[model samples]
Target: NAGIAATMPALDYPLAHWQLTMAVNVTAPFLIAQHTLRAMRRKQWGRIVNVASISGVRAGTGRLGYGTSKAALIALTRQFAIEAAEWGVTVNAIAPGPVDTPLIRGMHGGSTAGTYASMLPMRRYGTTAEIAHAVSFLASEQAGYITGHSLAVDGGFLASGLLVRDLFEPAASAPS
Candidate 1:
C-alpha cells in the first residue's frame, strides 16, 4: 500500500485522509483477495502476501491513519489465512521497518534519518532487497507450512526496546 502520511493529533487528523489511507491500505487487499481467491481455490494453491508496516504493530508519534489502516491489513491477512488455508492458500504479511527507500528518505531525510536508525538494534535502515528476500522465502514451496504470519523485516526494531541502561553502563558491561 502506498499510503499518504497525515500526521496530526487525533482531534486534528483529517477524516478524508484517514478514509483514503484505509481504503488503500486495508480495503484494497480485501478487494484483491475477493477477486483473486476463486481462481486460486480452483487451482488448490495460492500465495497472498500483504505488505503491512511496523506502525501497524507499534503506534508512532503522528501516524494515526497509516498505523490503524496497516493494523487492519494485518488482521485481514489472518482472517483470510484461516478461511483460505483449506484451499491450500497461504496468506501472510510483511511488516517492514525503516527502509532505505524513497518513501523513508522522503519521510526521514537529513539528520532525522539517524533518529530512526538509533531505535533499532541494528542501528541502520533495512534495504528493499532484504524485504524482497523475505517475501520470496515466504512464497517459496519450502514455506508451505508457514501461514498467517506477519514477518518483520525490521532489523530487530519491532522486537527491541530502548536501551537506556546500556547508555549508562560502563564500557566493560557493553556487549562486544
Candidate 2:
C-alpha cells in the first residue's frame, strides 16, 4: 500500500479494511502457497497468479490507500514467487486498468467509464475476460518460466504518459 495510502486516506478507516484487502489480496495467496506447495512438491510444479491492479503500478488519482495495498500485494506475489520457486511453484501478478466491472461502473457510471476510455489510447475500458485471460495464461503450464512478473491488462493506459494534471489545466497551458 505504498503509494495508495496517500491517495485514499478514507480506505484506511473502514472496520473491514485490513480484512478486506488482506484476504484475497494477501493471506489467500499465502494460504494457497502453504497448501499448494505440498502438491507442487509432489508433482514437481505449480502456478499461482495474483490479481493486482494498474493502481499497483503507476498509481491512480484518488486510489491512494487502495492502490498502495495493491502495490503491496504485487510485492507479496513476487516474494511468494521467489520463495516458492525452489518447490517448482511460479507466482505472477496481473495489473488491470479500468475495467467495465460493476465495481467501477457503479462507482462512476457507464458514461464516466467511457469517458475514461476516451482518454486511453485504446478508447475503451477493458473487460473482465481480458484480465482473466492473463490470469489463465499465468496459471497455464506455458507460463512456467514466468515468475514474479506483473502483466498489465490496461489496454495501453499504463503506457501513455498523458499526465492527468495537464487535462485539468487551462486551455492555454494544456499539453497539446
Candidate 3:
C-alpha cells in the first residue's frame, strides 16, 4: 500500500512523474508480494492488504498518473489473489476516499475539502482509523473467504451518481 498523488493534465503530464507513481504505487507492491508470497505459501495462510484510492475507482481532475497507477494496483491485486488463493493467501485492496491526512491536506486546495464534503453522501472525509479497520478486517481470519476484492472505504463516493443541483454547470459535470 504505497502511492503518490501526482496531479497534472494529460497534455502536461510528465513521463518521469508517471514512472515514479508506478514505481511507488504499483511496482513496490508487486515486489513486496513477490518477496513475501513464497513464505506465505509455505505457511498456507497469509494476508496482503493494499492501499488503493477512490481516484483509481473514479476519475478526477489532474489524476492521470495517480489514478492509472492505482487502477493497475487493483488489477495486480486480482492477479495475485487468483494465484495465491490455493495457498490460503488473500490479496485485497482498500480504496479510501478523502481521508483526513497530511497528504490529503497538502493535495487539496482550501475550497476543495468543502466541495468534496458536499459531494459525498456522508458529507465528510474519512479517518485513517476507519480505513485501518477495513484493512484489519480483510487481514483477519474471518475474511479468509474474501480475496481479490477492492473494498471501497469511501463515504459512498463510488456509489454516488448525482449530488449537485446544477448538473449543467461544468463544475458539477462528471470528470473528463
Candidate 4:
C-alpha cells in the first residue's frame, strides 16, 4: 500500500495523518506478512517485496509521517528476513525515488516534476519498469542468498547527494 505524506512540519503533524500513514504503509505490510509467512513456511519457499520510498532512507522537505512509516516498513522487512531465512523465505524492500507513476505525476505536476528530476544524479525520474525489474530480481531464485536488504532503485538519487546540474555545470570564468 502506498502512503500519503501530510507535508507538514514535524511539530505540526496531525494525529490522524500519522495514524493513517502508519496504517497503510507499515501495519498493512506487517499484517500481510503475518498471514503470508505461514504458507511460505509450510512450503519452505517464498519471496516478499515491500515497496518503500527514498523518503524512508532520507528525510525530504516535509514528510514526517510518510518517511516515518516507510522507515518502519524497512525495519519490518529486515526483521522478517532474519526469521524467515531458515524457512527459505526472503523479505526485502525496494525503495524507489521519483518514479513516473500517475501518483507521482499527480503529486509533482509540470515544472515541479522536471525540477525533481534535475535533483537526481540521472537528471531523470525512474520508470515503473525499472522499479519492477528490481522487485523481479529479488523475487527470483537467483536472489536466494539475498535477504534483509533494502535495494534502492532510485537512479542514484540516494548516492549522489548532489544535483546533476551542480555536478556537471560549466564553471564560471574567473576574473583575469
Candidate 5:
C-alpha cells in the first residue's frame, strides 16, 4: 500500500488524519487479504505482496501516523504469511525507502533531497522501478520459499546506522 504520509508532529496530528491513515494503510490491506485469501486457499497457490515503507522499519520525524500504520502492515503480512504458508500461499511485504514518486516529490522540499542524499548510503532517492522489481521478485514463483518476510528495498538506509561524515574523514596528524 502506498499509504498517505501526513507529515506533522504527534502533538499537532489530528484524530481524523490518524484514522484515515490507518484505514488506508492498514485496514484496506487487511480486508483485501482476508477476502482474497480464502479463494487462494481453495486454489492452494497464491502470492500477496504488500507495499510497506522504511518509515515502518525506522522512526522518522513527522511520520507518526504513516509509520505506525505501515508498521501494522508489516505485522499483518507476517500474520497472513504464517496462516497461508501451509496452503502454498506466500504473504510478504516490501519496505521501500524514499522513492522518486509524485507523492514523495510533493511531500519533499528542495532541501529535503540533499538531506536524504547525505543520509542514504546510495546518496539518491530510489526509483519506482527499483521498488517494483523487488515486489515482482517476491510475487514470483522463485520466492515460494520466502514468507512472512519484510524485504527492505532501501539503498542501505537501514544498514547505514550512525552515518557521520566526520567519522569517515581522515584524522589529523598527531602532534610530535
Candidate 6:
C-alpha cells in the first residue's frame, strides 16, 4: 500500500520527498481509473476502492507532510467519485488506523515499539485479515449503494480521544 508515501504530495528537490508515495497515493490510481473507466464506459459498471489511511482524517505530531498528503488523497477520492459516478464506477476510500503490518515494522522497529498498541481497547494491533474483510465487502455486490465514503477500520480507536480506566471496588480485608 506504500502507506505514508502513498498519502503525500510532491515538492521540488527542496522538499526531499518520495515520489512512490505521492504517485501511489494520488496519481497512479487516478490514471488507472482514467484508463479502466474508458474501457468501462459502455459497460457502465466498475468499483474503485482506494486504500487511504487514518492520517487522512486526523493528523498526529511529527507527521505534517505525510498527514497532509493523505488529506489530499481523501479529496482526490471525492473528486474521482464525482467524475466516475455517471459511469457506474463508484470511487471510495478506506482509512485504516494502526494495523499490524510490516510497514510499521520498517517505521518503528517492532510492533511493540509502534504507537498506541497497548492503548487500544483491543490491547493489540489490528490484523491484516480485519482490514481485508472490510475491503472484500467493499468489493462485493452488497456495497453498490456505498460510494465517496471513507470507512475507518481502526478498531474504534479514533472514537475516543481519552481512555477511561474501569476501577474495581476494594475487597474487604479481614481484621489483622
In model 5, the Cα lDDT at residue 57 comes to: 90
Q: Which tens-of-lDDT digit does each residue in 102-126 have in candidate 4?
A: 8878978767787768778799989
Candidate 5 C-alpha lDDT tens digits along 24-112: 99999999999999999999999999999888898876779998999999999999999999999999999988789787787666876
RMSD of 1: 5.4
Better of 1 and 6 by lDDT: 1
Query: Residue 148 in model 1: shift from native, Å?
Result: 0.9
lDDT of 1 by residue, 60-106 (tens): 75678888998998999999999999999999999988889887788
My TM-score estimates for the predictions, one after another, are: 0.88, 0.79, 0.91, 0.89, 0.89, 0.77
Model 5 spans with C-alpha error above 4 angstroms: 162-176
Candidate 2 structure lDDT: 0.73
Model 4: clashing residue pairs? none
Ranking by TM-score: 3, 5, 4, 1, 2, 6
Per-structure clash totals for the candidates:
0, 8, 0, 0, 1, 5
- Error at 31, model 5, angstroms: 0.3
Task: List lDDT for all candidates, in order.
Answer: 0.83, 0.73, 0.86, 0.86, 0.87, 0.68
Give the runs in model 4 whose Cα sits over 4 Å from its true position.
162-176
Model 4: how far residue 27 lies from native, Å:
0.5
Better of 2 and 6 by lDDT: 2
Residue pairs clashing, model 6: 5-21, 6-21, 6-25, 7-69, 8-69
Which pairs of residues have clashing backbones in candidate 2? Answer: 1-68, 1-69, 4-64, 4-65, 4-68, 5-64, 7-64, 8-64
Global lDDT for candidate 5?
A: 0.87
Q: lDDT by residue for model 6 over 1-176, one digit each (tens)? A: 45544222233322545455566666776777677778767788888777887777876554556666677777888887888788877778888877777886665454344335665656666789998888888877788878888888887766744121111133468999
Indicate whether candidate 1 or candidate 5 has the larger lDDT. Answer: 5
Model 3 misplaced stretches (Cα beyond 4 Å): 162-176
lDDT score, candidate 6: 0.68
